[model samples]
Target chain A: MSVSGAVSEIVAERWVERTLAAYPAEILPFLSGEHDRFRNPVGQVIQESLTTLARELLGAMDNRATAPAIDALVRMRAVQDFSPSAALRFIFDLRPVIAEVCGEVTPQLESRIDELALMAFDRYLACREQIASLREKELRVRALSPAR
Target chain B: MPETLVQIEQKAPRGDWRDPHVEFRKGSICYSAAAKNLGALSLPNPRAWQPMDADWKLPPDWKRIVLDGMKERLKKYRSFRLFMDICVRCGACADKCHFYLGSADPKNMPVVRAELMRSIYRRYFTLTGRLFGSLAGGRELTEDVIKEWFYYFYQCTECRRCSVFCPYGIDTAEITMMGRELLNLIGCNTNWVLEPAANCFRTGNHLGIQPHGFKDSIDFAAEEASEITGLDIEVPINRKGAEVLFVMPSADYFGTPHYYTLLGYLMLFREIGLDYTVSAYASEGGNFGLFSSHEMMKRLNAKIYDEARRLRVKWILGGECGHMWRVLHQYMDTMNGPADFLEVPVSPITGTVFENARSTRAVHICEFTADLIHHGTLKLDPRRNDHWIATYHDSCNPARAMGLLEEPRTILKSVCRNFHEMPENTIREQTFCCGSGAGLGTDENLEMRLRGGFPRANAVKYVKEKHGVNLLTCICAIDKATLPTLLEYWVPGVEVAGVHELLGNALVMTGEKERVADLRGELFAPEAHSVGSASEASHA
Candidate 1:
């Protein structure tokens, strides 16, 4: 393997690790340990999403590639016990992890990370809105229709 | 930033699994038991207390109360005593819990969750734990331990999926129930449980729907069903000489999707010309007390038999509900019965006596409907449900506690033409919980419900992607109430419904108007290549 490719891979692996660190320490083991997609959807999805996000950032920095992974992670986080800042906080962790692993993050990569964070925020808002609408729809149907 | 990253990454794993520490995150916990609800039931130590607060305002003798309560329970319930002593931490049940699978929290693992209570039992009761302390995996009953108990015990939905796989046959649901009972002793409880139980005790239903309100809801459902079927159905309320008393969770009359099932029940009963009465006095079949305390469970469950005897009904037929069946099938006779006043449930339409329910004298609506269909008593047109490529979710209690694995499926397959099963393991005996059962279905705990529902939703997602499945059916009221929200969050486009709702759609009611829509007011699609023929061709 080429030296640059190996370097990028190490940085991406570190990025995934740093992203997982944002969650509570209690669940860290299972999130990283369990590999079965059905048994550990949250863990598998979080890890896979971060890995994909890292790869997308390192490659073409494609919005199409990164949006889905970000959507999956952000959807899980939005429903969890996370404040908006905390939900989006992991996105910020990527820059430092990349810099520490490779001694530098290129200017283009830094901007891409920022763009990814913005997309995550958008997805997070969309999920919260969806939850609100779903709850409203449920309440409407749950109300006694004929009694009213 | 780098220092913070290092700190986050370098944080050591928790010291031991036995350490009593719980973080009360906002979305993960339930609201505290309302003081009024506890006081209404004459429970001890009624006070408003937040779970997040350091001072739980527990009684001064909280520790003694808990240990003594545990001692009394240990003597009374042999299963509890056996389960406490029997577990070997085989880890067979670890991944079986929906909460553990969803959140990946080790304590959510069934073994670890049970151990949270078992560890306290060890330190207080076992000789080795008393002598060796930490070495023997014993944990002291600190305030933090009580706090942890409240956190984790409530997290369990009491679905009992873990017990299905346990080699020692440890009933983790009982352990959770025991843990909750002990928590209640210290006035540590959730309002999601206590309020409904208190309401059930007072007004005879969880929502505290008074007799008039209950009648109104039933009248409304019957009216809607009459409009759909063009038959003016007679819904008897508190009739003294009715042969069977029909009781279902109050949610059926009020909650969405559940209301449609109520319509289904009304239409099916009318079509069959069965002699039945809907009692406003016994409006709820769900016993939230099962989630509270054993005594509370017994107190709440007695009403079913009480109403049956008072109304002089020969037998009782329960509507589509989950835990309601569990209590009726498993605990009702022992807790509230003999029920000698009620006769064995003999299906009037099919003449099939429910021998399985001869003791309890109560039959599930699925069993009743399945029997009728089996005897060819009702004419069913499966094509009515052809628009729905459906899959069935076996509600935990009905599937596990009662072993009601096939009755609902028999009915669903008979009614829905385009039906699919989820992955083999995620259905029937090994079914995944909707994650919002056991009084944890409150909006405050929505995040945990979603997390807990992920595995169920994942399986649904697989079938949805593979078969274009758009409907998820179950017979539980709680499933009807919560699965819609869970599916919307995790697997959008898959609507939730009750088995009987589909049955209502398919059941050709006598003198009924030409049907164009299923229950829930959704229109059936035009016959543009029927899914029935396509699915048959694929099978062929």
Candidate 2:
């Protein structure tokens, strides 16, 4: 495998191991599908894709990549007609998902994951509020328009 | 040949010899047996119904202005966004509509109905529409589209029944509101709605009827009340320091059945000896039509607070109108905050206080009447209502919108001995519209009216056929006006009356015998009181 590919696999393997360790026995039934990924020979493909996507999000150099991720989240939410409250609730759930996957990695990386998750959550909240204000202003302007 | 006398005699037929159906047909026949038994009450003709100079001219860059405005609003809330986006275009909501079931028009389909606004939002705001345009079925915003929006949005009563059945809980009422707000942005509003809204903004009533005219109407009603109750009680208007501010729709000042309800309130107030005054300003308590446009609604409601502040009244009593009660129950308190001076209504007679005080403390007329009856404040003769079998038609504004199902029925049952109910869905929160509600109660939209009113008319028809329900009682002014039109087309023989009309009939006035004999010659008797004394007694 290429060096970058191998690095991704290592990161994903570390993540899965930490997830299994951190999760309580009560949640074991829900964790069944990913167990095969850690044990089987074909697990690398699934592992590489997830880790690469996470790494890309984490390593986003400018606002463009972050924006696309935000947009994707918004679009998915819009399609489901999820309220801003519901969307924020989902963001809260993402913290535990990240912690379960990466807590056993280097403490530095675990802390970095936590910080990144928080930043994204704050950004999403800001975007939602901005959108809501814009909408209200639009309603007022439309209400006053002459052509209707 | 005095013109006023000729008009009075021509417009006002003698009560004793009039046909109930023909009396209703004349439109000017103000007194029925139900109203006469309560007292002689009459609403004033605003006497002036002129159109005002409105800002109908569109702005120079109107298209850009309206489109941008709609996009901005659509982008604001996740709840609105979700509702707008997730509609699957399923025709399930069509048959569920009283209008659609009545009219059988595909445009009445709630999904399609909402799409009138949804498609506009899509074209202006969505990326798919911006990039693909016509390929994605997006059309340019045109005058015709605006017309369609006007036509369909007003067709809705904003009843919200279809929303209950929607899997996604998508409210078409919200969509209709947005559409109307957008339409008003470009001066595309109808004369019937905008004129009334504008008049209410300026003159404190929808018909632009001034204080003198209002006072005259009240004086006439007070005279009628005096005739029946033998009490020289004045129907006070804009009287300062009154304990209660009696607010009702301007239509009640002139509409039949409604006029009697107004008198019933007056008589009950006098009987209970409560201090009250009707506002010369803020004459209307209902503005469900304004729910579609925030600006117009805010402008209209601004007077209520202003008038209350001016009069310094302690509490406001809302009349028996559906949409008016809904607006007061749900949004009025939120839109116009708490009145620190006012307390939740506590009955002077019974010492009972209204419990469900939200932001603003307002009581529906039925609640007030029901409480009075519950406390044994008023003497009733249930036998007076026994002339014909009767059933209740639930007005949409008070039922599903406000959870006011029991109060009206409770009052009706307590007053009327022969009162029967329609099917379960035909009453309560699941009740059908009279089809002429929301501002669709106009004469111009006959086809749409026929369609939207069909479901309600059909329900009334079923009751009339199976149960011999001759009198259809509801507690709304709009129903009184519109149901007559619908009954004419669908159920020919059934008649509609206000809940207060029934109560007025059953009210045991102190000097009814002397007043009845005195007015019997001047007023025709046979047409007014169709039900014989024996029939009334049997049910009593």
Among all candidates shown, the one with the greatest DockQ: 1
lDDT score for residue A129 of model 2:
57
Best by lDDT: 1
- Model 1, B363-396: lDDT tens digits are 9999998888888777777777888999999999
Clashes of 1: 0
Q: With candidate 2 superimposed using the best TM-score fit, by how many Å does residue B526's alpha carbon deviate from the native?
A: 12
**Residue B444 lDDT in model 2?**
43
Docking quality (DockQ) for each candidate: 0.35, 0.01
Task: Give one digit per residue, the lDDT tens place, for model 2 in A1-148.
Answer: 7654555455555544433332233223323343332121112222333354455534442344444444433322321213344433433333454455445455554555555456556766664454344334434533442222
TM-score of 1: 0.91
User: What class would a CAPRI assessor give candidate 2's docking?
Assistant: incorrect
DockQ of 2: 0.01
DockQ, candidate 1, vs. native dimer: 0.35
